[model samples]
Target chain A: MNWEFILGRSLSSAIGSDAAVFALAAIGLNLHFGYTGLLNFGQVAFMALGAYGLSVTVATLGLSLWWGIPIGLALSVTLALLLGLPTLRLRADYLAIVTIAASEIVRFVARSVSMRGVTGGSFGLSGFADEFYAVNPIPGGSYGFGVVQFSARALWVIAVAWGLVAIISLMVYVLMHSPWGRVLRSIREDEDAARSLGKNVYSYKMQSLVLGGLFGTIGGFMYAISQQSVQPDTYSTPVTFYCYAIIILGGTARVLGPVLGSMIFWGLLSFTDTALRQAVGAGYIPTAIMDGTQVGQSRFVLLGLGLMLLMIFRPQGILGDRREIALDAH
Target chain B: MPTDTWVDGVTPEPGVAKPDPILVVDGVTRRFGGLKAVDVEHVEFQRGAITALIGPNGAGKTTFFNLLTGFDRPDAGTWTFDGRRMAGMAAHKVARIGMVRTFQLTKALSRLTVMENMKLGATKQKGESFARALLPPLWRKQERGIEDRAADLLARFKLDNKRDDFAGTLSGGQRKLLEMARALMVQPDIVMLDEPMAGVNPALTQSLLGHVKDLRTQGMSVLFVEHDMDVVRDISDWVVVMAEGKIISEGTPDHIGQDRKVIDAYLGASHDAPTTPEEEQRQLAEAEAALDAETAEREQLQP
Candidate 1:
C-alpha cells in the first residue's frame, strides 16, 4: 500500500480545483435554499445549461471562446426566469417537483440521439478548452511542494478556478450582509409579512433565483474548463444532491459555509476511498464480507449514515443558527 | 382629547360619513364563492382618530380590513386613501403610500432578530437595492440611521432588552408589541391593526391600549378590529358596527353599546326589550337553565 500516494491525493483533493467547483455550486444552492428558502432541486439544470452553452456555442456554433462565456451566463439567467415565472406563485413543493423534473429532462435531452449535432450525444464534447489555456502565463513545468505536484496546465486551471471562487465568495458575503439580503431572509421566514411591509415578494424571489442560478453557471464554467469536456451524465441529479449535502454539512446561511463544506466533503470522500482500497488489498477484511469492487459503494453508505447522524444531532451544522434550519415551507 | 358620553339607549342607524374623511370606501364587495365575505356599501374614516370596527363572528370585519389594506382584492368597488385611488393597488404599494397594517396572527419574521425585523420596516432603505447593497459606503450611513431608529422604537416598546433575540423567542404578547413597533417603523400615516388585543394577557392589555392611544396622540389615524367591547369602549373615538356584511350602525361607543340592532346581532333576533326588572331576571334565569340542560346532555353523551 502506497501511503504517500493516498495521503497526497487526499490533501490535493481537500483544496483542489474540484473543491472550488463544488464550493461555488454549493454557494449558489445556499443562496436559494439557505437565504431565500427556495427549494430549487434543479440547480443541476442551470449547471448543465452552462456547460452546454459554452461548449455548443464554441464547438457547434463556431463562436469564439470569449463569446461562449457570456452566452452561457445569459442562457442560465434565461433558464432561471423561465423556471421562476410559472412556479414562483405556487407552493414551495411545486418548485421542488418542477426543478427535479426539469433537471432530468435537460439531461435526457442532452444525451438524446436527435440532438447529437449540437449536444454531441453520449460521446460528449471536448477540444473547446484550448482557448481557455492559451492565455495561461505559466511556463511548462511541474510545480508544487512535498508530495503534492501539478503540471503547468493543471496549475493554470486551478489558479483560475480558485480565483473565481474567492471573488464570488466575497461578493456573496457582501450582498448577504446588506439590506437586500435581509429581505431575502425575511421572505424565507414569511413572505406575507414581507409583502405587507411593501417588499415585492415575487420580484425578490425571482431575483434570488436568477442570482443563484448565475453562481451555478459559474461553477459549471469552472467544471467544464477543468475537465476540458462536457457530458450529459456529468451533470446528473447526484451533483445537485452533493451540493445540498455540502451546504448542510458545513452550515447553511453562513458566508464561508460552502467553502469549508466542499473542502471537508471532498477530502473525506477521497480519503475513505483510498483507505478502503488499502484495507481490501492488505486482507484486513475477508473477500466474502467486502471486495475491492464494492469499495466505491460502501464509502457513500458511510457518508449517508454520517449525514443522518449529523442531522439528528446538529442539523444547524458548524456555523448556522438552529433557527435557520427550521425551514418554513410556506 | 375626545371624550366618550354614555348614552343608555339609541336607535340602530347606518354609518354616517365623516367630513374631511381620510379614507372613503364606495360599494366595495368581496365574495368568497357563494358567501359574500364583505359587502361594505359606504364608509369614511376621520383623520387622526382611532376607530373600532366591531362585529360578531363571520360578520366580514376582517375581510373588510383585508380589502381596505389591499391584502385581498374586492370583486367590485372603489376606494380612495388621502385623495388617492387605491382599490386595485398591491399591498406593498399601499404600504409605500403611508398605509401599513398588522395581522391578527402576528408575523414577526421569526428567524430574524427583533432589531432586524424592525429595520425591515424602514422605507427608502438604500441597501435594499441590489446594486447599492454591494457598495457598503453608499448605504452604510443610512443603515446605521435605520438601526438607531429601530433601537428607539424598541426602547419605546420596552423591548430593548430583547433587541438581539430572535423574534420567534418572544412571548405572545411581546410578539404583538414587536409587530406594533415594527409597523410604527414605517412612519405610516394610517395604522390598521387586526385584533391587536385578541390573545394578549390581561397584564399587558393596558400597555397595548396605551400604545393604540399613543398612535392617535401622535397624529396617526388608527383603524382596528377588536372583539373585546371594554377595549373598544376604552380607546375608540368612533365605533362602526357590522352585521351580515353591512354597517348596521356607526356612532359614539355609548350609542353602539345600546343600539337595538347591535344587541340583536349579538344575542339573535328572538331577543326583546324587557319592560321590568323582574321580567329581565326571569328571562335571564330561563336562558341559564336552557344552557345548563344543554351542557348536561353534552357531558352525558361524551362519556
Candidate 2:
C-alpha cells in the first residue's frame, strides 16, 4: 500500500536490466519488421539459440563463458541464414509462419526430456553466469535513491546490459542513415523497384535477417547473464510477442522507439501490479467485484485493450510516420 | 525530305540503320496457356536513339517489354544487349548489365523518401557493403556522393523540393517522375520505359518527353512503350508496331502509322479467324494482283 515503494520499483523496472534486454531484442525486430518489412514472428528462436548456445557450451561442455558468447552469436547467424535462404525468395508470409514455428520447435527441443543430459530438461541451466559476475567491476553494497536500490552484482549486470543497448542503438541509427540502410528501407517499400535498380534483393533480405538475429542473440545473452540462468521457458513465443509489443508501443523504425517502449511497457506492468495488489489489500474495492486472483490477471487485459486502441488510433505507434507504417507492397 | 528515301519518296535515312543497335530481340515468344502473348520475331533498338514500341491495348507491347527486360520469361526466343545474351537473366541481373526498366504501374518505394528511392538505384555502387556500413568515413563519403547524384536527378525531374517527402505522398505524375529519375541514377546503358506517359498529366508529358530526348542526347539508348500517338510520333526516332504477339511492321513513325496490318490489328481484326481453303486460295491470288499493282505504282513514282 506504500506509494513511495511502488513508484520507486516502477521507475527502476522501466530502466532496469530486463528493460535493456527487451529493448535490444525489439531493436532487432524493428530492423526486421519496421525497416525491412519482413514479418519475422520467430525472433525468440534466435534468442533461445543464443541462450542455449551459451548455456550448453559452458555448463554442459565445461567451456568458458567467453567462448560461449561468440558461439551463441554464430549460431544465431546460422539460424538466420538457414531460415532466410529458401524463404526470402518466396512469399514474405512464409517467413512469419516459419519463424513462429521455428521458435516453438526450439523451445520444445530445449525442454524435451530426451535432451535432459545436455539441456537439463525443464530445470534449465544455472551457475553458468559465475564467470560473467567474476569480471564485474562494481564493489560490494546496495546503491540507489529513494527506496530504489540495486546490489553490486545487479548494478554490474544493468551497466553492461544498458551499455550494449546504447551502443547497438547508436549503430542502428547510423546504419539507417547510410546508403545501405536507405536501400533496405526502399526494398521494404518497393522491392521490385529495388530489383530494377540492380539490388540483389534476396541477398539484402538475408543480410537483414542475419543482422537482426545477431541483435536478438545479443539480447538473449544479456537476459541470461542478468537472470544468472538460462531456461527454455524464457525464450517462448510470448517473448517474441512482448518484443513486438515494445516495438509497436515505441514506434516502428524510430531509433529510440524500442528502448523507450520497453521502459514504458515494463513500467506500466509494474505500476499496475503494485497498485492493483495494494488496492485489493486496502479493501478499496469489494472482493465480490474483483478478487485478488482476478485483479492479478486484469493488468494484461487492460494492456491488451490499450494496445488495440493504439493500433486503431495510431497504427504507426508513438513516433512513426503514417506512410512509413502503411506497407502496401507485398 | 532531305535524306535518302524509301519507296514513294518516304525518307529512310532519318530512321534507317544506325551504327549499332543497343538491344536486339530475335524470335522472343511468351505464351500464356495456349495464347502467345508476345511473339516478336526481330526488332532492333538503335544505339543513342529513342525508339517507341506502340500498339493498341492487348497488342503485346507491354508483354514484349516485359520479356526483354527480364520481368517475364520467354518460351522461345533470345535477346542481346551489346552482344551479351540476356535471355534467362533475372531482372536485377539484367539491370546490373546496364539495362533498366520502369513499370507500367509505378513501383516507387512508397515508404522511402524520394531521395532514398533514388539512392536505391545506385545499389551496385561499392559502399553498400556491410563492412562499409560499419566504417562511417568510407561509406559516409560514398553516401554523400550518392545523395549529390540523387539531388541532381531530383532537380532535373523538378522534384527537388520533394526529396525529403515519402514517395507515396507524391501524386501519380510525381511518382512516375520519381521512377524515371530513379532509373537515371543508375546511368544505365539502355532504359526501357513501359507506358511512361500513361496516366501522366498533359503538362508533365512535355517534360517527360524532354527527358527522353535528353537521354538520347547523352548517348543512352531508350526503348519506350507509349499509347499516345502524338508523343510517339514526336519523340520516337523509329517505331516498331506489334499486333497480337508479333512485330507486324517496323519503320519510321510515319510508316508504322499508316501500315495496313497495323490498322487491322488496332481495329481489332481477328488474327486467328478460321479461313476456308477456297478463301485462302482466292486471297493469295488477290495478294499477287496487289503486289503487281504496287510494283508498277512504285516504279512510276520513283522516276
Candidate 3:
C-alpha cells in the first residue's frame, strides 16, 4: 500500500475544489437554517440557477461572463421572493414543502428536452468558463510540496473559490454580531415575540431568504467555473442534502461552521476511500468481504453511521451551543 | 386603593367614558366562525391608570387583548390610540406607535442572552437595518448605549446578575420579569400584559404586582388581563368585566366586586347574593366534600 499517496490524496480533498464549493453552499444554508431558523430544502435550486445563469448567459446568449453575476443574483432573488412572500407569513413547514418541490422543479425543467436550445438539455452547456480562466494570473505548472502537488489550473480555481469563501465568511461574522442578526435570531426563537417587539418579521424573513439564496448563487458560480460545465444531474436533491449535512456537522449558527464542516466531511471521505482502495490492492481485505467498487458505497455508510452517532451524542454540531439548537420547533 | 378617582361624576357603567381616555374602542369585534370570541363595544381606557380586564375561562378576555393589540384582525370596527386610527395597522407597526404587550405564555427568546433580549426591544436601532449592519463603526456607539440601557433595566428588574445567561435557563417567574423588562425597553406609553401573574409563584406575585403599579407611577398606562380577584382589587384602579365576549360591567375595583352582573357571569345566577350565613357555610362544606372525593378517586386510579 502506498501510504504517502493516500495521505497526499486525502489532504488534496480536505481543502480542494469540492470542499470549497460545499463550504460556500453550506454557508448560505447556514444563514437560512442556522441563523434565521428557516427550513430551505431547495438550496440546490439557487445553486443550479447560478450555474445555469452564468453558463447560459455566456454559452447560449453569447453575452460576456460579467453579465452573468447580476443575472444570477436577480434569478435567485426572484426565486426567494416567490417562495417567501406567501409561505413565510404562514407556518414554517409550508416553506420547507415549497422549497423541496421547487428545487426538484428547477432540476427537471433544466434537463427537459424542450429547453435544449437554452439549457443544452441533459448534456448541459460547456466551454463557457474561458473568460473565467482568462482572468487567472498563475502560470501553468504542477507546483506543491512533494507528494501533495497541484496543477496550476486546479490551484487557480481553488484560490478563487476559497478566497470568496473567506470574504463571505467575514461579511457573515460582522452582520451576525450586529443588531440586524439579532432580529433574525430573535425571529428564529419566536416569530410572534419578535413581531410583538415591532420587528417586521415577514420582511426580515424575506431578506434572509434572498441573502442566503445569494450565497447559493455564488456557490453555483464556483461550481460551474470549477467544472467548466452546467449539468442538470450535477444539481440534484442529494446536493442540497449534502449541504445540510455539512452545516449540521460543522455547527449551525457559527460563522466558520460551514467551512470547517465541508473540509472535514470531504477529508474523511477521501481518507476512507484512499485507505480502503490501498488496503484492497495490497490484499489487506479479501474480495469476499469488500472490493474496489464497493468502497464508494461503503464509505458513505460509514459517514451515515458517524452522523447518526454525532446527532445522538452532540446534536448541536461542532460549534453550536446545545441550548440554542435544542429548541422545540414551534 | 389608587385614591385619585377616575372620571368623577361619571356613572359606573359598561363602556363608561373616561375623563382622560388613551385607548378608545368604538365597536371592535372578532368572531371565530359562529362563536363571537371578542365583541367589545365602546370601552375607553384611562390615560395613566392600571386597569384589570377580568373574566372566567373562554370569556374572550385574551381574544379581546389580541384584537386591540393587532395580533388578530377584527371582523369590523375602528379604534384609536392617543387619537391615532389603529384598527387596520399591523402588530409591529402598532408596537412602533408605543403600545407594547406581553403574552400569557412568556416568550423570552430563549436562545438569546438576557441582555440581547432586552436590547431587541428598543426601536429605531441603526444596526438593525441590513445595510447599516455591515458597518460596525456606525452602530457601535449606539449598541453600547443600548447595552448600558439593557443593563440598567435588568438591574431594575433584579435580573442584572443573569444578564449574560441564556433566557432558557431562567425560572418561570424570572422569565416573566425578563419579558416585562424587555417590553419596557421599547418605552411604550401603554403596557398590555396578558395574564402577567398566571404562571408566577405566590412568592413572586407581590413583586410582579409592584412592577405593574410602578408602570402607573412612571406615567404609563397598564391594561392587564388577570383572574386573581385579589390582585385586581390590589393593583388596578379600574376594572372591566367581560363575559361571552361582551363587556358586562365597568367601574372601580370595589364597585366591580359588588356588581350583580359580574357575580352572575363568574359564579352562575344560582349563586344568589341573598343567601344566609348558614346556607353559605353549607355550600362551602359541599364544595370541600366534592374536592376530597376527586382527590380520593385520583389516588385510587394511581393505585
- The top-ranked prediction according to lDDT is 3
**lDDT string, candidate 3, B168-275, tens digits:** 889999999999999999999999999999889998999989899988999999999999999999998889999999999988888988888999999986875537
Ranking by DockQ: 3, 1, 2
TM-score of chain B in each prediction: 0.91, 0.82, 0.92
Which segments of candidate 3 are over 4 A away from where they belong?
A: A323-330, B271-274, B281-303
For model 2, the docking class works out as acceptable
RMSD each, Å? 3.0, 9.2, 2.7
lDDT tens per residue, model 3, A1-330: 888888888888988988998999999999999989899999999999999999999999999999998999899999999999889998899999999999999999999999999999999999898998898899988978867888888899999999999999999999999999999999998999998999999999999999999999999998999999999999999999999999999899999999999998998899889999989999999999999999999999888898999899999888877777554432
Q: DockQ for all models, in order?
A: 0.63, 0.45, 0.71
Ranking by lDDT: 3, 1, 2
Candidate 3 interface RMSD after superposing interface residues: 1.6
* A145-257: candidate 1 lDDT, tens digit per residue: 87689889889988988888899889999999999999999999888889889888889899999999998998898888888899999999999999999999999988888
Which portions of model 2 miss their true places by more than 4 Å?
Answer: A322-330, B1-19, B270-303
Per-residue alpha-carbon lDDT of candidate 2 for residues B65-167, written as tens digits (9 for 90 to 100): 7788777889998878999999999988988889999999999788777888888888556567776876778866777888899999899999999998888
In the order shown, the chain A TM-scores of the predictions are: 0.96, 0.96, 0.97
Q: Please report, in order, the local distance difference test score of every candidate based on alpha carbons.
A: 0.89, 0.85, 0.92
lDDT of 1 by residue, B82-191 (tens): 99999889988999899999999999898889999999999888999899999999999999999999999999999999999888888899999999999998899999
Clash pairs, candidate 1, are none
